[model samples]
Target: MNIVIVGAGLAGVSAAEELRNQGCPGQITLIGAEPHAPYERPPLSKGILLGDAEPDSTIVHDAQWYADHEVELITGVPVSEVDIDTGHVLLGDRHLPYDRLLLTTGSVPRRFPLADRSGADVVYLRTLDDALALKSRLTENLLIIGAGWIGLEVAAAARTAGGTVTVVEAADLPLAGVLGPELAPVFVDLHREHGVDLRLGTSVTAIEQRGGRTLVMLADGHQVSPDLILVGIGAEPDDHLAVKAGLDTDGGVLVDAWLRASDPHVYAAGDVANQEHPVLGRIRVEHWDTAIHQGRHAARNMLGQDDPYDRQPYFFTDQYDLGMEYVGHVGPEGYDEVVVRGELDDRVVTALWIRDNRVLAGMHLNDWDAIDPIRSWVGREADEELRNTASRLCPR
Candidate 1:
């Protein structure tokens, strides 16, 4: 059997490796948009930006390794079209046929509104090239738009490199949308402790090149002139290809519990897939753990092996001398009471969002002991007293 994977991100590469491990003794071709080999993205915002890691350190596997495993990698060639009827993918003038096709085209960085092609001052951190570009521009003063994970990671790197960093967010709190209002203040404090000027409830009204620097105007009638600017709002799934091919598409490429797309021969995984969960029902998770897990699931199903992908969701980010881990959705209503497993005074805390004596969400800051029991609580299998002891939000 011949298999073709459309992306070279962690998901696609993981799928290819799993297929090999599963003993699929046919041709496997991995197509990537980037000219470089497959690499990890997590370090790009941390060690890489801080000048501690070399560009070559992120590669998941070298060229010779791929060749040894009989995996053909075609880098810098993006699949422009997927002809489902013909069972072929078109890349420029070349075409490749596949018995099974896996779509793992991760996501693209969301750009700032004021950014333009000519505005060399604006940068993003999605690809290796993007990280390298941002690394080169870390001169003196660096302004960041959005206080999300990527943005805060960049700010940490800039501050560690002896550059004055400033973060501007439109929300009242830095991580208002993700971590909610109560826990977001910790992030603000963390940034402040690192000497970062984090301006919340502030939006960039205008950005233009003035002399040798970039002039940033905020909605509050404040102006900032910086040598470099990094925008890290978020990422949108690359689902246009799946949609154009007549597959079901929602916020992401819709997939079943088996990680197969609406089509039988085609499947989607990773950040591009909005899969059906056994417990949570339907959701689109853009976490690294989910990506790797779903990719392996898709690979298994592709090889005629049926295994349900029912794993707990987990994601974490290291920024500003703190590690934040989140599990499960906190819901829209927000937490009524936050249970602290550890004291916030020690700069380490695990806040649990509890409602009706059940754990809805859990946020860990420099604390991993709370995660295991919380994970059991989230799965609804742990003892009540164990959860009660681990969580401090018991009812009166």
Candidate 2:
């Protein structure tokens, strides 16, 4: 059997490795659009951008690993089309036939609407090249045009590099969409304490390059000039191949509980797969852990295993001295109440999102031991005693 995977990100690489490990004697082909091997993206905004870690250290697997594993690794080449009827993927001028195909085509960063101005002074931190470029230009004043995870992370890294940092967000608080209004102030305080000039409830109207510096015009009729601008609004999944193949798509490639697309021969995982998650209903997750686990589970299903991909969503973040691990899912209605264990000001706290008296999600900041307990509390009612006794919430 010939297996073809279009994308060399964590999901694609993990699927290839899992297929090989399952003793599938098939010709496996892995394709990537980027020149570099599959590398961890989380470090790009933190360690790699801050000069604390080298690019090589972030690689998922060394060059020798692929050769030793007998997997065909093609880099810097994108699969232009997928022919579902013929069961083949189209490269620029070549076609590769495959019995089974997995679409792990990650996501592309959203850019500002300004097109006339050259992006020479603007940066988007999605790929390794983008991170390196932003790192090289981190010596002067840096302005970030979002307060989401990527934007805040870049802000922290820029501040660490001695660059005067400013963040502008259309929302009233940073990460309001994900963490909600109640817990969003924690991040607001965190950035302000670090000397980050944050402009909330404001949007960038225009960006102009004048006198070698970029000027950012805001909706409030205020303007600010900075040495560089980084746009981190969000990302859209690369689901063109799936959509062109006549597969169902909404926001991302729609997949079943087994990560199988509409066509049995084709499957999807990672950021591109809008999977029908058992616990969270129909959702598409862009977290690293979800990608890794989904890749492995999808590989098993491809090999005739019927195990469902039912793992709960998980994500982590690191900024300055603060490290956080979040678990569970809270839907669109938002949480009824939030219970905090430990002092938020001290930076060692676990915030639990309670809905219908059950713990829907929990975020641990600077506290690692709460991961297991917090995960176990999901779907279970928040203990009244534990809520009051902050010390016992995440007991040692």
Candidate 3:
């Protein structure tokens, strides 16, 4: 059977590798818009931007690995459309037929509304090209729009490079959507302690080029001139192909527990898949770990393997001096209560979300102790003594 996979990000590459490993033995073609091979993106704003690592260090598989497995890699080309009825994918002028297909197009950064042709100085960081361009233009003063994970990471990088950095965010606290208000202060401290001029509850009205520098006019009638600008508000899933094909599209491409889309022939995974989580129930997540797990699980399911895809969600971010690790799901109601394992000053903080005396989800900032305990706590009854002890709420 001929299998075609569009997108060569982590999810797409994982699916292709899993297919070969499952001994499909059929022709496999992987197409990617990026010129480089599938590489880890979490480090783009951290290690690579800080000059600690090169771009090649993040590659999932080298050229030799693809050749050894007889997997074809098509880079720098995008699949314009998919012919579901004909079982084919249309490139610019080329068409390739497939018995099964996997969509792992991933996501793209959301640019600011003010970033029109007039706002040429404004930049974003998502793909390698974006990073490369931003890297080139980085100078003494850098203005950052949004204070999310990526924006803060860029701030760290800019500070390290001896650039004066300022981050503007409309929200009261950065990362309110992810770690919630209780934990966002830690990030705010990280930037402030690093000498970043953070302007919270501020929004940009317009960006104008002034004397080779960029002027960012705020809604409150304040303006800051910077040598360069980087916008990192958030990312939107690239689900155009799935939507155009008449596949079910919700927050992302809607899929069942098996990661199968509306059309059973086409499966969606990675950031693009709005898949059902067995543990979290019917919720869609855009996480790196989820992408890898779902991509492989989708491949296995495509090969007639009957494995229920219940996964404990996991993702990590490496900032200036900390590796932030998170696991499990935080309900909409939010964490019932937070327990700190380590002191903030010591740079080791593990915040646990407890409900009914059990750990629902945990966020570890520079602390690895919560990793194993969190895995075991999910889907199990609450342990009062352990929860109290683990949370350090009770007297030692």
Best by lDDT: 2
Show the colliding residue pairs in model 3: none
Candidate 2 accuracy as lDDT:
0.86
Compared with the true structure, the alpha-carbon lDDT of candidate 3 equals 0.81
Model 3 misplacement above 4 A: 356-358, 392-396
Q: Can you give the TM-score per candidate against the true fold?
A: 0.93, 0.95, 0.94
Weakest 10 consecutive residues of candidate 3 by summed lDDT: 387-396
Give each model's whole-structure lDDT. Answer: 0.82, 0.86, 0.81
Which residue ranges in model 1 land beyond 4 Å of their true spot?
117-120, 332-336, 381-384, 391-396
Better by lDDT, candidate 3 or 1: 1
lDDT of 2 at 319: 83
lDDT string for model 3 (62-127, tens) is 999999988899999889999888899998899999988999999888867776555556677887
